[model samples]
Target: MWRLRDKYAIAGVGYTAFSARSSVTVRDLALEACGGAMADAGLMPADIDGVVSFHFNDSVPAMAVATGLGLPGARYAIDYQAGGNAANLIVQTAAMAIEAGLATNILCYRAMNGRSGFRLGGGRELAAHGVTQYTAPYGWISYPQAMAMWCRRHMIEYGTTSEQLGAVAVTCRRNAALNDRAMQRQPITLDDHQASRMIVEPFHLLDICLETDGACAVLVTSAERARDLARTPVYIMGAAYGGGPNQGDDLFDAMRWPDHSHNYARYIADDLWASAGIGPDDVDVAEIYDCFTYSVIMQLEGLGFCAPGEGGAFVQAGRIDRDGALPVNTHGGLLSEAYIHGLNHVVEAVEQLRGQAGARQVDGAEIALTTAGAMTCGGAMVLRN
Candidate 1:
């Protein structure tokens, strides 16, 4: 099979200030981010030939961004109907398109007013459809409730404690304290995590991710071209997207699923590493998705950082802290950082590999791994400088 490793690179990354409310429209937010990415790459808007973005029916289309950025008849433009799970997959798609000779410079982005409008926690009534029809009437209306079931299952099956989950939240906030752009920079203790009001039974208010109005974007191009760009070229070492058994079915239908204790990470880990020609230990830093605290522990187990049933203990031991064996979410992550879906995670990985992450920078960082989503279908990627 053909390999994508080292063939493409993330030439540039950019983000707008994250906030609870924005004075501008989501389209304006996307334009600012895309323009910033282009400028960072030392490219003009006319040089871009492709545009890609993902949203949960909350943002504008790729063409709208392309036109707003003044791209001259974009060659390839698409908007995936997805959420955080597609974060890595969209970059992979852009790179594949570049390799296929479809587009040269593609801008992949995610922009949303997750806090000011269209909250993921069910700010508005959703039409009854798919498994939601069966689950919604029973009060399973938001993502937190659906994810809480999986968290509870992990606790029951592996004796995971709320304190262990608290470790993840506390660590994220600690990292966010060093990130000027993070929404929640105040450090919190495990006791604070425990004392915070519960949003769902297994998730405290601090355990959940922050919803912010913001946009993040990256520029994708061939490695050869990226070498001549403005910043250090972070090559795409590998990428994988898909899920395990019954993944094609409605993911929220936990009743029909086989294992609630695990997630998509395990199924994709082998392929992700094999394609990258590295293992978990080879990774210098990681940006695992943390939509919720337990999601981080679950991905840690599934991504081969630790054996099954060891994730709770792994986190409790501080293996994911800034000074741990493998520093993770150095940009504060979704829990404390602004949630641009998971696209900001990818941006953070690029910065780490480029040696651009200032104080939180992992010493001599070379290879970086980033994962998006946990319980449902997800994707992951490896990057290297």
Candidate 2:
């Protein structure tokens, strides 16, 4: 196991109100979230020495946010290349930086105008690249089409049904209703999910995540330093990030794996557990990435919440409800809540651990598991109170 486990902790978290449209630029959005986080941690701008962010270079960079916050120039600033699946890397990288004595009081954040500015799913000129050469030519132009293909395969092989998937959407909306910061707070029922417009054959409009305009930030420092912070410390128990075998290779060729139905989470689950010295049984709450309902189901299976092909049944049993065996996405998640990439999931986990979540708080959340996406690349982190 790594000595770094539990060495660094999240002292505070903050976010801007989620919305589909925001007049401010992404830079301002980042400042709002960072300022809130700084205040929550009781830290001054001069205290921060490091920063990290992900997704495309289009979003505000780490240095830009640092400057906006009036910080003494950062000693370590990184702009990671991966997208949503690499969200947890921001926290993990900051932990390593602090452990290495390279910096202290790192601010990790993500901000974007996903709806009004750069449409995440907007058409881009294909570069005729490696993977694009294989799939894009066959009319698999968007994530919906690509993920739909995977969901269809799961349905055929595992007997997963659209009704089972509807349960995920229903659960998220129910959670969103209790969160004032969420963009989509209106309650939704499974019947409403079925009645919603179809984005793809098996996926409905409600099944997809909202294109949100928002920013989320978290403050990380040594666990000892966190003891002096304004908020209770949430320790980083475990974390891992990497690609899975056969992911995004060739749809047909990738199917030859022994467990082809599995996602990248399967590759990192053991590392996350071993590093934390805990298993699924120790988890009090989960914040699974829910870019789509089907993806959440797949992650549940991969994370060992249930056996393979049993995810649909697991969710159908209400095992992931707020009061169920393992409450998941208690802050609405990306499905109904605004998508600030996956940083909001981390914030929610911190709140759950600190007992700060008001109505949506799980009764006694002590160990919270927050995850990024599946597919080609992914990450997960275990946070403990």
Candidate 3:
């Protein structure tokens, strides 16, 4: 239904190696990824006219790079506020900008030295969020705890088991072994997962995602330019982001959903699918956000791959494994890969579409959808050739 198809396309993508410490500053990381992307698109720095990404990025570094790249008359510097979703939302907005003749070339990026920077693992301070403030400051700490709380609830109310949760982590490590660029390249088994230390009550060390220092960037421009670039252009087939009114909540307070007693994940899935004109079954590959292992299972069912209480069974049956119908997180995901606010998953999906993913490449990935979630926050995008 949306007619902006050929108006804009992702011409290229680039990412710094995912690692705990890359020995580079955020400024160098942004430039590395951006330079790679521009080369991939066969575009010079002067070709860009606009830029978009998260507000968390260091602004001075990017401004200097824009001037260094010599982007001619770059006017719009759009900063979408929604963290992980921010990158994809920028993609949507960039498409709009191109359609409106506001800008011709746009770039979306998320770069951070989280691991070595000392900010990520420093302390609890994120409680600025009302619910997190109440819970996190009281020793809830960071992600695994917050995510584990959600996991424990699912187990309590729906009879979920730890083994079912381990399956997600195990499969991701298996996939990571296939992705050389992944931070965690060592192969892992279920025993390895179970043997890992427990970070939170219901979540193990393996259940947690990797915190690494890295950056990823993508170049988006008109489809015509995409054709003139290095490879087949992955089109932005469908995208949608929503909150409140219908769900009676915001992404900030994910558990506040009034209906279905906290079906927040399902609510995001409903909106994303409605806008895409496709469902879980139509997707060739999926790169769902896995900030925590259980979250992947939670999203699978929430996005309608199976029934609500059936997610555990679905994954336990190897349905999400590489040989399974829906090979998810084919790039190792945030669990084994770096946590760049879920932008890596978007890059992986684009690679899957381009057939450039080496050993981990899906046989014939034409259409894929990626979903990212953080409590009340989540976003999805569809891409095709």
Candidate 4:
């Protein structure tokens, strides 16, 4: 173990209002988030020397954000590819840059008008040539369709039920109801989830995440430097990256990965716990990536909160609520809150650990776990106040 614990800290966090539509350009949204993060850190635009973001060339890149903010130049600028998995990668990469003495302050942000501008699921351009060539012609061009197949297989292998998955949505909505920043503040019941229209088999409208316009940013710096900043430094106690066993060279073979109903997080759970010097029992709260209801249930199992086939039972027991054993997605997550590509999960973790989450705060939140993505390239972090 390299012992990266406490080497880096998140000094500031900020975001724009979550909404269904926004007239502003993506670049403007990026700048708005960057400016808020910088202000929260008690620094001027010129003080930042690094920028990081991720998208399919839809959001503003790092260099553009640097120039737009009038930062003379950035020592480290990166615009990673893909979505969900790229969330923790951006911050972890920035932490590496700081460790290398390459930059003093790194700004990590994600901005987009997912609903009004362009919907991520309506395109097939990102698929492998194998998928576009074969599956695209058969109506397998969207994420919901592909993920539905996977979720259905999990249900078959583990005996998971849609009602069990609905529990995840209900819990997230309840949490969102308490979060003023969450887009879906209205409470939802299991009945509501089961009654919602089905987007795909095994997934209802409530099971899927919201498509909204918003931006989120977080500032990362050396733990030593962060000790002197505006807010309580949420130390990066551990960070781990892992991907699926194998993303098949083609979609045909890739479709076989879910036969076992396992996610890439299973590959990294031990490493994350060891790096953080704590086991799952020590986690005060969690901010899981809830792009889909089943994703949350499966992730809970993959992250070691419960046995492989017990995720449905675990969640059905009300352990994911605010007063439950884990209290996951305390800020509503992507399911009820606007999906900012897991960046909001990071913000919520920082807030919980700092005791600033207000009404949704987890009691005695000394340590928090935050995850990004699920199926493909994904990562997780352990944070401590």
Task: Score each candidate by Cα lDDT.
Answer: 0.90, 0.86, 0.76, 0.87
Candidate 3 local accuracy as lDDT? Answer: 0.76
Model 2: per-residue Cα lDDT over 1-385, one tens digit each: 4457888999989899888888899999998998888889999999998888986765888889878888887999888876678678899999999999899999899999999999877754766576666666676676666567677878988999999999999999999899989888999889999999998887888878889899999999999999988999999999987656556553223343445366777778888888999999899999998888888888898878898899999999999899899898999999888898899999999999999999999988999999997565689999999
Candidate 4's residue-wise lDDT over 1-385, tens digit each?
4268998999999899889888899888889988998899898877899999999767778888999999987999989876887788799889988889899999999999988887887766645475466677677777777678778878989899999999999999999998999999898889999999988897888888988788999999999889998989999998888756666553223554644487777877888899998889999999998889888877888889999989999999999889998999999999998899899999999999999999998989999999997675578999999
In model 3, the runs with Cα more than 4 Å from the true position are 1-7, 55-65, 125-133, 244-255, 259-264
lDDT of 1 at 4: 92
Candidate whose lDDT is highest: 1
Score every model by TM-score: 0.98, 0.96, 0.91, 0.96
Candidate 1: pairs in clash:
none
Counting clashing residue pairs in each candidate, in order, gives 0, 0, 1, 0
lDDT of 4 at 71: 93
Please give the ranking of all candidate structures by lDDT, highest first, separated by commas: 1, 4, 2, 3
Which pairs of residues have clashing backbones in candidate 3? 251-376
lDDT tens digits, residue span 1-385, model 3: 3456445688889898888888977777877887878888888877888777774433224455566567777776666555554656767777888888888888777788877874444454653575565555577566566567777777877898888888998889899999888888788888888888987888789888887788888888888888888878998877766433443232334445543222435766666666666777888999988888888888788778988878888999998988899999999998887788788888899999999999998898998887766455456778887
Give the Cα-based TM-score of candidate 1 against the true structure: 0.98
Q: Between candidates 2 and 3, which one is better according to TM-score?
A: 2
Better of 1 and 2 by lDDT: 1
What are the C-alpha RMSDs, in order, of all predicted structures? 1.2, 2.0, 2.7, 1.8
For model 2 the local lDDT of residue 223 reads 98
